[model samples]
Target: MDGLIDRVETERKLRNVWHWLPDAVSEFPIETWAELNVTVADSNAPYRPVTRFESLLQKTTTVRYLRPEVALMEPCFDVLYRQVHDGVDVTLIDRPNCHTYFLSTYPERSSELLQQDNFTVLEHDELPPYGTGLLDERVTISCYEQESGTVQAVIDTDAPPVRGWAQSVYENYLSDARPIESRL
Candidate 1:
């Protein structure tokens, strides 16, 4: 056919709109979380570790932190390696520009694996506000942040599994606090 149909014209409009509203009040405070973006790598260090960790992190759903140095990421990688062997899928979502969310179904296993010198177990209230409904369907998930450039993991208190996993991991970490010095 010479022509399939009549010609059509389309118009597109872009608008910038702003709104004013009152603040919200809740029993729990709404916290803020900044995206983790580590764009700097140590110039003196070899490029392998930095790219290795960055590549590993990128294999997951999404990761905010990037270009972490060897020293900063080595320990985390070690723990992650052990965690993997222990049957916990640890995916790096963020690094210490602050926090790393290990995307796994076994939060307890991940927590136990991460209980080391650099890793700390955090409570739900202690965590910054993440996206709403992020954990609604998740029964067990592990998320961590850093203290003084080290890694830490947290269990979602609102999750039913947290009542058991979080408490046990917290106790375990407190009972045995030691630094792990090894590489994968």
Candidate 2:
């Protein structure tokens, strides 16, 4: 593959990407999701439950507040994970320093309809522009430059699941909020 992102590497990256997505999104099967150049993990923290991620925002020298997709990618991966079987093994290969289009599709086998594909845009130098078609109301990205290191990413607002984040975060906070009670 010309762009060639390692399967394992992508899986790991995919997992990291989920941090940007909304918590309302469903979880992907770890085994299956491990196929892509990116994958999702338990995080193990459990303390910081995911809610409205608001996308990924980082400021770096290479890029600026560029695209919203990049910001929402974390939650996006969560949704994607459910759609792909053995996706963890699937490498999201693409050319370096390029832009690509990611289309949403419905696989006959799976029921969920919100899945995205990563395409490398070597033909284009800049990252691909955001699309309005994804599950979100408006998906976008913004990038900013840093003097020395780090890239800044900004995300626009999107509709949360009808239930919203308040309930989930509250539940988590309450469940573990209390100090451990001991019965003598």
Candidate 3:
């Protein structure tokens, strides 16, 4: 801790990406936009302090990422994620207009691990107001349903032309990282 950047400075560095996106967007559920707030925690990295981020969807479609605690519990799904579940809630405001499919690959693990052995898509209202993943951490999706809320029609994880991304940035704030007397 003595030789590294402090927590305050780390938060500023982590927020670099959040502050870099567009300011507003339209086409949202309530005709309103959200402030982007997300948790910056790499597999082995320390948790960065929460900060609000914003990305414009259209002229009025903007979603603000916020809070890490909410993600671990009930995901707004507005952020990057992969979910695995046995089932999902069917009751919602609006439902998906089209049929969707979920694929399962056995190369990674055993089929017996899959509780339901199927992919489930929940209703739009059943999901959070923000973006979210159809599947949990497992290779399969949860219950299958209709949706059209703030959630995307379909998110392509492997798509190359997709928009929106979050990455970490490090900064140097220590007054003296190295002793001036030593130079190598």
Candidate 4:
């Protein structure tokens, strides 16, 4: 009863992508905007993180890059731009080809890793609301748990270009969507 790839066991792992740089001092600066929050979901959600990211890109005008996780690089097809970070070549979608990206790290243990490496937590709360303006407008940066545990960062936004983005995300992407918790 065994065959070549016929076992066909489709295993799922959560993934994530940050909207900030590796050395970013803080999270997306929440200025005159409304609110900020973090969200989570199951691995079998109807929409993939990349699909959500692509939707965001299509709605916005400035989003021009996406640095996806190592695991999803092959699935993240037809990106417009590519960049090399720490000896790892990453792909990003920009402008007309805008897309999403994920990091190959865990948001929960990000704080601990920061001291060991030049990493920053992508949590929704710790991100200084008054520090650097990492995001020009509200953008949803998303990812999955380190070990495919849960879907992290769904409502990851700085300032929503339009109202109801959170609501929209909840409806389309989130399952539990715990607010103001540090997943990264």
Candidate 5:
């Protein structure tokens, strides 16, 4: 009789726990616009977190950008330039190919951009073919479409684990990169 009572009690506890679980198929929004600082572009919905970074820049004292392509730099250049002008520390990492493209495409602007006291740009041969930005305590990741040459998606998160992982990746690349001025 004791065994039967124990089994019944266990089953009752299991049922209680099951009732507390969230519905997997529910249509409720998982995150609000403020919580999920994500932006999707392109036909396939790629991440483009530039707007989030721009907004975060207002409150950030330091900014780090890891970019693989020159084209990706154009959109955020104005915001970054303004931040650097306003005394925010900014670091940019990209490939040598991107440097060459920047110089060719914006010969005049490159001089002004590189001459800023608060700005530092580095080139790394082994930079992965994607973009990531660190603004203050938040991290934003941008993926691109190889064929369309457009941003696919940008994911922004302040989650501790995700920020830690992104910081690790940024540090690895930053260590391997050489200052663009040194190369010039």
Candidate 6:
């Protein structure tokens, strides 16, 4: 039976393909990062919960963040303040809007945040189209979909290519960014 043999061969190929697929069994979207002990730096959306970066700040020795929105930066101010006080190296790259928000709304606190020795604030006119951060060896990249107005983050700890790309993007931006004092 030629038809029967063909069916058997098809089934065998299907089984082989199934074995090659990854066995990911997690309910949360970014659970793989948690399993790998990778820190995720996600942007704060109005509808979503606070990002894990707040909790990771306690244990992270170094932090590099590119923040496009002032609202997203507000919640983590206190945590960053504490981390800088604890001698963590914190570098922030922000757009002009963030500086305006701080100077107009929270002048005193903003000054305190910028004046820390362990903290460095840089301003850029335009940044790469994504929000990205590095917490030690972990790299997180958030891209916004213009059509849907939705944001998604790709967090990786072990992938060399992803880490290299993130580092390259960060360094490129950092090179052209101006210090906050220069902007003042």
Tens digits of lDDT, candidate 3, 149-183: 11111111211111222100000111112211121
Per-model TM values vs. the true structure: 0.20, 0.23, 0.21, 0.31, 0.70, 0.66
- TM-score, candidate 4, is 0.31
Give one digit per residue, the lDDT tens place, for model 1 in 17-109.
Answer: 001100111112222101111122234543433343434443433222212222444545654455445444332222232233332434465
Candidate 5 structure quality by residue, lDDT tens digits, 1-184: 6556554553443342232222320222323222334455544432334454456766788888887354455676676667778899988898787788878887877788789888888988876556777888877666665565465556566756556666878998888889987867
C-alpha lDDT of candidate 2 relative to the true structure = 0.28
The digit string of per-residue lDDT tens for model 4 on 109-163 reads: 3223233322221222122111111122554544444564233434435544322
Per lDDT, what order, best first?
5, 6, 4, 1, 2, 3
Report the lDDT of model 1 for residue 44.
58
For model 6, name the residue pairs that clash: none
* RMSD of every prediction: 19.1, 20.9, 21.4, 17.3, 12.2, 11.0
User: Candidate 2: lDDT of 88?
Assistant: 23
RMSD of 4: 17.3
Clashes within 3 Å, all models in order: 0, 54, 29, 12, 7, 0
- Output the better candidate (5/6) by lDDT: 5
lDDT-superior candidate, 1 or 3? 1
What C-alpha lDDT values do all the predictions have? Answer: 0.28, 0.28, 0.22, 0.31, 0.64, 0.60
Q: Candidate 6, 6: how far from true, in Å?
A: 31
RMSD of 2: 20.9
Question: Which stretches in model 2 have alpha-carbon errors above 4 Å?
Answer: 1-79, 83-123, 127-135, 144-153, 158-184
